[model samples]
Target: MNGYRFDKLKLLVADDNQHMRKLISTIMKAFGTTSVYEAESGEAAWQSLKKIGIDIVIVDWQMAGMTGLDFVRKIRNAPDSPNPFLPVIMLTGYTHIDHVRLARDAGANEFLAKPVTVKALMAKITSVIENPRPFVRTKTYFGPCRRRRNDMSYKGPERRAAPDAIDVDGIRPVGSGKTGSHGP
Candidate 1:
């Protein structure tokens, strides 16, 4: 709260549960976010996103129709998506690592486990604003860069030459007249 302010942000809370929506809305309001909107289903949330100008989105994973995962996929992969780069904070009770990975793969900018707290929620928001992740776009993926930090300790197969090209380490160049792998 020192250098960051939420007063001017327009945030959306999308959840099927009424109490959860209210609680999140209350928390955002407390954080000085005046323009907070709520949607009961992912469909409604998608509509809101297409209609209004949303700064950030906090979406629940589970919903009646068009689950949060689907919504995120649409935002990231859909041709007519309103905003592909819009910041999204995935809200879910599933704290499992697999769930986290799933959310990340789906293009969420951040993740917030359920039973949300002021500190944790604010931390997510601030991180998104203060330190935005570079967007990644490839043939199979489009979203925030999954890597959080650089690791020089170990080596792994490099997948792409640039963010837009898939240059795998063990793949033959097309039309090179070579029909074999490059490396192990």
Candidate 2:
């Protein structure tokens, strides 16, 4: 029987380990990635990317040719390209926060430790795919608004103006015997 979705997604899984590459591709296929691509090295991954419209990239931190850090830097530095908005996830065996921070600073949208579980991996992929953040800001405004995970601020629909209450105008006795208009 078929499982979760496996369509309309072009994912690239880059790793030096053939086994790991297949594992990630299979997992992504199971999770409804229709067009999953695999690369055995950073250079191969970069070459594949040049030829395909990859929606997400799962890269290993350590690679033989251009390291994952270098690959990410390349993507981030290519700000003028049409596909510069690609969401990248760095996969590594390292657990240090500094390592994770460095990956983020180097243009990684998310970081995952090696031997990643299907649940965690799927969650990470889904998060990045569904909520890719903006790399540059065109404009910013501050008001009563909430920011989405993608960093887009949304101001809710405009509120309707309150209806004016009915007014009664009539001559009324004020103070002694003087008459005056009561309402307007």
Candidate 3:
């Protein structure tokens, strides 16, 4: 049963650049993806959505016919919502803060600054799958970490920890005080 859980996932790659679309599609296939649908522009991407189902979307920031942001807006606005809870990763060469903010506002779950490496893309996919919420940067003894949910506010980290519950960095606890207990 556990083996079946990690089956191939269908993905969509949307970019006006033909080479970019091919590159993303190829990378996804290399990552054990089952199928990858591609579109040269947002308009074409929208049409593709109407035809087939996709598990996730990897879109370029700038495109002709319609921008990637607009494509996301359309997906989120569809009557039947092609993928209502679908995860989207926006790729852009530009690193402007405003662009990142715009992508967030436009319903992007992850952002990859351009010249994105295969390792970076894989890491982003892994992180988003493990925690499907906005990424919040936080520092810890381990290293720079990402907090998944907004409500994960640790009140000075004084609470007893769970035995099997690993930290955000997937590190197992070496020692613990107790479990099923409370503190003041």
Candidate 4:
């Protein structure tokens, strides 16, 4: 709240649950957000996104018309999207590691599990405003950089290269192709 000017920001809240929408909106207003939009489903949210000047999006994971994960994918990869770089905060009841990874892979800038608290919501908002992640474009993905920060303490060989090191042809360096045999 120190540097963030919530009064000037425009936010869109997308959720199928009416009560959830109202609750989030109320919290947003309490946090000094003056302009907030609501959508009942992902389709409706997409429509609003096309028409409004939204600074941030808080979308639930499950919806009627389209899932939140799909919505985020569309926003990040769709050629007709109004703002591909728009910051998105994903809200989901599923707090499992798989769900979090899915949200991240879908290009969500932040992830917030359900049973939302004012403190967590405000923290996420502040993070998006104060420390925005850089957008990255690759053959398989086109959204915010997946890596949060560089680990300077690790003296071993670089596990991942910097985003700037990516080639102009949208090629990302290949990592170890091993995948864990367990879990979702």
Q: Please, what is the TM-score per model? A: 0.81, 0.69, 0.69, 0.81
lDDT of 1 by residue, 10-108 (tens): 999999999999998998898889999999999999999999999999999999779999999999998989999999999999876556657777888
Candidate 3 structure quality by residue, lDDT tens digits, 42-145: 88887787788777788998997799888776666557667656788888886754465466556677778778688878876776676676332222111112
lDDT by residue (1-184, candidate 4, tens digit) is 2756779989999999999999999999987889999999999999999999999999999887799999999998888999999999999898755566577778888888879999889878878887777666656677775656533354453234443332211223344232211111
Quote the positional error of residue 175 for candidate 2 in Å: 74
Which regions of candidate 1 fall more than 4 Å away from where they truly are? 150-184
Candidate 3: global Cα-lDDT? 0.64
Better of 2 and 3 by lDDT: 2
Error of 4 at 136 (Å): 1.8
Off by over 4 Å in 3: 1-7, 134-148, 152-184
Residue-level lDDT for 31 in candidate 1: 82
Winner on TM-score (2 vs 3) = 2
lDDT of 4 at 90: 94
lDDT of 3 at 49: 78
Candidate 2, lDDT over the whole model: 0.65
